[model samples]
Target: MPLAHPFDDDKLKEECGIFGAVGVADAANFVALGLHALQHRGQEAGGIVVHDPVHGFNSARRMGYVRDNFTSHEVMQTLPGNVGIGHVRYSTAGNKGQTAIRDVQPFFGEFSMGGAAIAHNGNITNADALRRELIERGSIFQSSSDSECIIHLMARSMGRTIPDRMEEALRKVEGAFSVVAMTRTKLIGVRDPLGVRPLVLGKFGDGYMLASETCALDIVGAEFIREVEPGEMVVISAKSGVQSHFPFRRRQSRFCIFEHVYFSRPDSILGGRSVYETRENIGRELAKESPVEADLVCPVPDSGTPAAIGFSLQSGIPYAMGIIRNQYMGRTFIEPSEQIRNMGVRLKLNVNRALIRNKRIILVDDSVVRGTTSRKIKDMLLDAGAAEVHFRIASPPTAWPCFYGVDTPQREKLLAATMTEDEMRDHLGVDSLKFISLDGLYRAVGEAEGRDPKAPKYCDACFSGEYPVAPTDMIEKGFQLKAAE
Candidate 1:
């Protein structure tokens, strides 16, 4: 399979996707479908752990796409269970190699309570410190993933029950996490205090479902049963049905705003709003915030399409297919070298010469990261005889790297972290460039009055650099924080 999509190399990457099902017939099969729907969240590897009363626990983890690895009857037959949890991984904490498979998740730990399998969907910012502490105490780690810290923590907990152990484990951990886990009879789900990542509860017939997004629930024909509230844990089993526990100190929810911007699939619903509609609203906000005269408003394609349409309607510029993307290409194209990444863009996206010849174009994209892709696209448009290239970005400048779940470039590597709008425009050789203001983004995402200076509605750390969760590990490791440029 292709390593990554050319256009996506410049985007923030979500670390993983998690799904769990309890009291379902062919539980692994339903979990597989849920993971397939959430495939956009992570593509590196996929795994599922199921528990059968007769056979105990069974697991299968493999590198590459879910369809290639998990869709077979042979694989499904082995995972015979009524309760299961699954994970699709994209590495954020570990190095890439043969050993990387060891980090492939739905990481199983045989606790004294019982065998508990977990699929975690966010980063644990203080994991390094926790890992060291655990290791020094004779805890043997099986993988390099930061998520394994939870397993070890749970193992050491004195709680008599599995859920109690899990709650005790989470209370000591720090940072964004949405976790789905399973024991022989119960499936459990939890979101961090900030709700930095998403976890939703769903129901299908007598079974219960838990996933990162509503789209996954739709795939399994599950009814949306509200989100697993932040700092709350839900345990589902045949006997208990569903039990809810608020185990952490209550805090204001800080859902990752980037979920609407780029990470989530357009069809998914987040924060009670359709992701596609939210994106269109973002485009409308972008148009109102930064209007420009142009022959056409052209999207970067796929991720940028919804916003581009909204921009076209609001700006009165006809939308055109100026850049065509290779439909077969994956969301990410992992180039081993810079030389290949530079050329991969051309292979993935081709300028529509007939539509763009001598036309003034407004390029609408989600966000500009390193600016390398933007620069290449500008060159491509100029080469295709475009009279002018103006850029209208849907979100505010990404000035900080995410320590939550997203794999963001360091501060220095982020173009917005160092360069002014004019500087970026000059660097990309664009006629004009503008990004929607932070307040405007809030308005688009349904906060009509804009972001509250004191208590923001969502996590805008990547743009405003106001991190809800402290990067404790990074600070301890001597990573300096610079003011937003």
Candidate 2:
């Protein structure tokens, strides 16, 4: 069967997911389960590398879902190790084909010190420059991915141990990175200085785990330990247990706000708050900021469901399944071609003609990226005889593209990037449209006082464009940064 695209063809795509475990029997099995929980982060490819005392290191990397590739006993048997790391990848930098397998990670590198396999989440803003420098220094790159730079940097580092070399390597790196690496007997996890991405430490029996989200930990029956702090490197070994090192310079935390908005699983906990509750709060905030009188408050489905519920309660509008989504249809946004993506909305979502006909409907959705899906939904609702369609977005206008880990389109391609609220409503042919204000978004995420102009609570770069980390390579390559509106 041909692979289906992601659920929504218009939202930002998460780059990758990382999971690792040490001191466990069938460590690869546990890692596989953890990756399954994080499948939403990336769906293009999956890989696992395990380190067995007798077998040294064994690996399997395939371009498909974890269940299809790693669930088989045949594939799991090949990776027999007590310590391992795994990755689920989506192509952001590399080519998308069979040749891209070279970039499928849990990327293994053999240094003079030891052999290590690394899985990374988030983009390296300065990767191009680093890659160029590494190439000049006689480092032959095997893949087009920026993540390969980490391995090369570690290889050339003067530090003696793998952890030390990793720290040294990361010091030269600039951008958001949550990395899980396994070296012989040790499993390592590291978060960038700004904490742009998330990595958590979890405990399962006598073993330990490092994963991109708490949801991954839960899949392996691991107890929630604590998050790996920003600028911290956690080295887990049979002998040492868990040891932490602060390798990077100190910086304030700027966790990706989109995690709470759309990326993370609703059941997961982030920053001491439940993602589901946060999204509901976002709906409540939206209702307060942008209220519309309508017969029914409807969600775009799945992503919009929680907020629609909250909006219903807050606005006193009845919630109904005005639009239904096909659970079997994967994310349509991940489809390669524009033509497929253009047709994806119809394939994934259908209007409940009976419920919406001749009624004023409030359409609640998470975020509008290109506006193609929203426009199509509006047309569909009107065709079904809906008298009025009012769009209520749970998040602020997505005016800028995300460069960290999210696969967002360029600014020019974003709907909010070029149009005002009135223009967007007119373009979508909706009766009314309103987005949650930036302050309202902050409020919903538990920031009661709203965003601080000086030091924001979370990374809202996609909405605000005030990137905490400079896009160093882009700047060096003559890409001027646009000022945040």
How does each model score on TM-score? 0.96, 0.96
> How much lDDT does each candidate structure score?
0.90, 0.88
Best model number under lDDT: 1
Alpha-carbon deviation at 173 in model 2, angstroms? 0.4
RMSD versus native structure for model 2 = 2.3
Off by over 4 Å in 2: 1-8, 93-99, 331-344
Error of 2 at 66 (Å): 0.9
RMSD of each: 2.0, 2.3
Q: Model 1 segments beyond 4 Å from truth?
A: 5-7, 93-99, 331-342, 482-485
lDDT by residue (tens digit), candidate 2, 1-485 = 12435334577778899999999999999999999999998888889999998999999999878888989888999999899999987777334333378888978899897799898999999999999898998999998888889999999999989998889999998889999998899999999999989999999888999998999999889999999998999999877799987977788899999899889999988988999999999999999888878999999988898999999999999999999887876633343676765564777889899999999999999999999888889999998999999999988899988889888777789999899989999998999999999999899999999999899989998998788999897778675676556
**Model 1 per-residue lDDT tens digits across residues 1-485:** 43555455687888799999998888999999999999988888899999998999999998888988889889899999899999997767335323267889989988776799998998898999999999999999989888999999999999999899999999999999999998889999999999999999999889999999999999989999999999999999877789998999999999999998999999999989999999999999999999999999999988899999999999889999999998876654455577775574787789999999999999999999999888988999999999999999998999889999888887889998799999999998999999999999999999999999899979988998788888899889787765556
